[model samples]
Target chain A: MGEIWPLFPAAIFLSFFFLLVLIELFTISLTKTNVFPTLEPAVEILKNGEFHNALLNTLAFVAIGTPLELFAGLFAALLVYNSYWGKSFVRTIFVIPFAFPGLVIATLLFILFDSQGGFANHLFQGQYWLFPKIIDHDVAWRGSKYLALSVSMLGKVWRDMPISMLIILSGLNSIEPELIDAAKTMGAGFRVRLQRIILPLIFPAMTTVLLLRSVEMWKEFIFPYILAGNYPLLGTLIEKLYGFGSDPGEAAVVALVLVGLTILTLVVIVEITGRIKRVLVNSGVNSK
Target chain B: MSYIDRDEIGKRIVWAICVIVMIIGIIAPIYLLIKYSISDPSTMNTGGRPIPLWPNRPTFDIFLYLFRDREFWGVVSNSAIIATLTVLLTSLLSIPAGYVLARYNFPLKRFFLILLISVRLFPDISSVIPIATFFVRANLHSSFISVVLAHTLLSLPYVIFMATTAFEFVPKDIEEQARVIGANRVTIFTRILVPMVFPSLIAGAIYTFLLSWDEFIFAHFLLDTGGQIQTLTLYLNKNLSFSPPQNVLAAISVCLSVPVMVFTFVVQRYMVSGVVSGAVK
Candidate 1:
């Protein structure tokens, strides 16, 4: 007993994890919803290639959305890098969305894009009136899976872009003014200076932002759940596994898959990036 | 050349565009939410675009309704109680823990540090099931204590991270000076270290409070019995989902976010420096 006392903390931690798994199982039974209905059915779904399709959709969303957001953030940062009038206010305004809870943003978007009498409809039909034909048409943003996914992406971009912006802003701040000055003296334009100098110097920060945002987007739940409604991302799927009326076994499988995927991605990114960084540093040193 | 003047004008124009985009993307949406809160409930169902810039008839009926509702007050109290307790418990545990980690070279310190960082990185979904079940088995489910415990899990990591950074910045020479005067460890900690890091500690405390205040997942899952331990976020979610009148729901959301905004406004300076110091350093 005395000898085993040291293992108490470990035991407690394991028990806590076990308890979580148990609750997950209970919720699955309680929910009665299944991610993979049966082993055979899941196999059939895989064979039918819906699983592959879903996987592709998830990957595509991450691939496209992540880079777009990162670029948008960088662009915004660069636009606001110089100390200008109202810069602080702009920064504060941009960060407000981040501070507001995800749930609120999701709900607000829902209100704005509702098919009937929504702001989108009003805008299309009113002042601009360019899309008159489209304005008359009932566009069910929430009903269509594609539309739902798009809204989810938009919400994520809105919430997450600021994070990247903050990161890039800090990175921009760290870059030496001499480099920019030298480039300008050599008759380089703003675009030339940005492409050649700013981008390379901020690559490390960009990598960090990319990694963090990707991981965050992968695990994001509430916004996607609320916005996409029926459409399930991996996060939403895991959530459903734990939600009432979910099938525990299938949910467990999904949860395990998610954990595995996340670990795999993190490992791959870290290893690849670490190697690349080492190579770059070594090459620079050898050149010097 | 005049081309350079044109380029500067272009840059200013782009900056203006960026500011406008930000206002539309970030400010307008929040403004709409606030606007919806004051709009009459009757107008919500009419399905007009509800020009949020200025409502035709603005009223505080929704706010009045929310304030008058006992359940709303209950949720507010629950949120306050839980956030306060979480802040207190987290600060108490994390300050000393962070101090030890920062100042001392304990055995397995690196491993512990790794564990802390790993826990912070672990997605909340991975731990939610186990944490919830543990609470249930312990007969702490759906209670304020369980909620506080859950919040502590979320808040502790940040607290420790922030507090440790603060602790590290406290001059070691001061502690040595205290020791030379025959001051005990406790005295050194309370009198010397505490005062030095008081601002940072307060900043951390405020952050923890905000975290607990905003945390929804565990609170939503753990608190089953309605009105027993419903937080502001939970209450807002419940009301939002239950098809409460849009104005009322919006009002509740506004109320819910008000505290966070106020807190941010109050602690923005301290938080900015604290986060920059701890994270960017």
Candidate 2:
């Protein structure tokens, strides 16, 4: 027992709060307006149109945002992977995004994407001479649900890209340089080395990024709440229900669903990544 | 040109372009933020004239306005008070727990560690409702006490994780020597073990401070109804709802962000380890 006294405070504090949260969450979800325990809140939420919309919107957000983050991260990692002048400088720049508060980033995106003469609209509408006209009109970024959600996803991806980059960069650093040099000496080109050697080696890092980023996307609130308030994700829906709608039962239900989706994403990613890694390893051995 | 020379040149060009794009992507937004913060009314309200890339007449009037505003100071003080309390409480709870976890071998140690870390994996939004509900029922909602406790709960795991690593990094021989020298466990812990891990513990404390400072969901939920107290995050969110002038929002955002950004750059070396520790483990 090594003197159980030291760990007691933190253990009790954590467990008490966690158990309280779990019990309260379920308790609120199963009841409405001081009614006895019932499934009405969950049932009603499941049958609501807004809930469905938020669910579908959240799925789209995750589907688009997660992979976008992976690609953005992978791009940044590969950019700084090779030895180059000012490598640390470039790495610092990539990390700067993560340094900013998410609220600040969302606010900045709000300013730049504002409907009336926003920077993005000006640039895309060909007001800026350096860039060709991508659009004929100043686009109201939050004009439609899809547009609003897209902007939210863009902000989310931009803010979180650094986390993915750092994770992938650490994975890249763990690859021994000699392995790549050996491949090159054996007449393997960049493409071949990337596909065969580098990709499989960093698959776990990519998987980690995917799993973490998807969970993040599923629970994303600030960006959507700020940039796309008209449309709701599961995260923002919880806020709307609890704060404005005054429906704690329904809010708790949505919160539970968000937690469920996060766990489900975690499981699905782990299983798929595990299977894929096995296949990749077996194929690599067979090919050799 | 030789084949190698041509290939090298092509690669350099691509690398330069990519680097330029990345730099622009990161810097442009920040520049726009600063620009808006400094922009005069003429620059912001141009009557549909395309806003200049540079503000026509930049000024720090909004910054001065915020500095002079009592309400802004109140919000700033609230955020500072909450963040400081969270750091103190989280560190106090976590340091000893982390020390024990680092040094002692006990039954169910793995179980305890997972229990601590798994608490982090729960979605903050999902967890906040129940917590907020509890606070309201206890008549503690909107008080500094509830917000500090909530923020401490949010950051306790990371501090514990960081503190454990900090304590683990200290060589065991020093502790053993102290014990052999007739020093009590408390004396050795306060005198030897803690001093050795002080730097890393400070890092853990800073991390806790940042988490509490940047926290929003709990602060917003707990304090929204009371309307008596507001943190910087809630202030910004409330201002955003009323569609305040962009310059004011930018200035407030700058105030809220500068400390975090400065600390991040100053402690850039510890960042990777800290980030990886929280995420991967």
Candidate 3:
């Protein structure tokens, strides 16, 4: 009722967070070292191999991971959306991967991709359940940067795709069945129905999923930090600089980069959600 | 979920294939985790030219062995205590905060909203440094209190979002009806709105609990004391270096994930609803 119940608690937490960030920022460049760490050094720092790899690695992660997850999620949503039988049953179990902590998934996959007796390489050994020479030798998945980073992404996709499924499903519920029926009567087959009707209708929700997923991938630290070892992404780089290397200055620069990316994504989310809300209104879904 | 007819053989075929692929995807990691946990730690040479997909021999003794490790249990308890406290504290603060956010508009409301969103989305990498420094300065560094406070900051932002959405779900007419009955805001809140959104609030709490339970960054930096302060997550990561036996590691991982896995399964619908409400709105 009063401002105190919510405002006070929020103020306390926000102040703490802001205070930490401010302190790190000032100490990093403005106070201790240089005048705002001009764009030149920032660019140079970025151009360096270490940061270049991290940035490339992170972008690669977002680029490959987001669409893959969306398709997988949309596929799952399609299966569960219309199925009335045991809907809850499928959902409850299917979300098992969704329920795990990213750290735990990272750990499990880290070992699962182990070189010796690790399933990532060993699972498809001789029998070749799917294909021959699919995985013949023990590839040390976490040994190198690319394999480790990509394998870690598999874990992230598993944990997050179900969420994409849920959001898309919620959006699915908003679509009028009459439209689908009309489309069907017009000689639309399943593929056409999916491409013409379902895809366009669920596009905003899909946008929402991608936006959130992008935000998550932007801040992704645990998966890479744990599974990929010292190789840094934007997420793990800040941690490495601040925590491991003890260089708050470089850490601040990277932190600012992440902050900038996050803010941009947040603005995009606001815009997308605004679009979704307008869509919902236009379609007479929520209306209120 | 599509609306295609159930009797459509073609659609059913696609549906079954997609579901099977998804099921296989979901089961892959879990199957491996369980396989390692139950299998013998040493070599498995089954009819033997190459590695088998599963163990030649599986046993539950790894779990029994893990239960005997007092250090593991200690860290597990630390994880529980912190996560439990985080859930309670986060819910307590989030409820009223959520209520105010849903209903009221005050000075600096826009700023606060922006701040809340940023805080929720901000990577822990940046904020963790200065916060950890401040805690260190206060001499509360690496303590349970420091770790819990750090975790509260992480959970609070999103919990407030979750809470705000939950409160928004309560119809305004309901609150107005209570007002018509001569109820005060506090009475209406605790008596009416609370009950209506209690499940969502609980869902939010469980989420917060799981976050702290699974959190590593804060626990890693904050818990400087090795044996006493380490949470299960930190323990898991630390053990990664020591090269513990595979079964033991798997058992511990299973132990860490089981609570969250079970809780999500039990409250599957509520959690999904909570997510949709928060995200879509």
Each prediction's whole-model lDDT (CA): 0.71, 0.88, 0.77
Q: Lowest lDDT 10-mer window, candidate 3 chain B?
A: B272-281
Docking outcome class, model 1: acceptable
DockQ of each: 0.34, 0.71, 0.46
> Using DockQ as the measure, what is the rank order of every candidate, best first?
2, 3, 1
Candidate 2, B65-130: lDDT as tens digits: 999999999999999999999988998899999999998888878988888877878788999999
Question: Where is model 1 chain B poorest over a 10-residue stretch in terms of lDDT?
Answer: B272-281
Tens-place lDDT per residue, model 1, B153-200, is 777767877888888877687778789999997798898788778878
For model 1, how does the per-residue alpha-carbon lDDT over A1-288 read when each residue is reduced to its tens digit?
Answer: 432233235334433544455455445333323443346423333353334544565676677777878987887787668646877877777777777777677777777777765665566655343335355555778888788788888888887788899999999999999999999999998778876678778878888887887777666677767767577776666556456634344444454555667777778777877887787678768978
Tell the DockQ for candidate 2.
0.71
Q: After the best TM-score superposition of candidate 2, give how far the Cα of residue B135 lies from its true spot, in angstroms.
A: 0.4
List runs of model 1 lying over 4 Å from the truth. Answer: A1-57, A126-134, A271-288, B41-52, B225-228, B272-281
Candidate 2 wrong stretches, greater than 4 Å: B269-281
B144-200, model 3: which lDDT tens digit per residue?
Answer: 888888888888888888888888877688878779989997898888888878778
A best-first ranking of the candidates according to their TM-score comes to 2, 1, 3
For model 2 chain A, the run of ten residues with the poorest summed lDDT: A1-10
Scored by lDDT, the top model is: 2
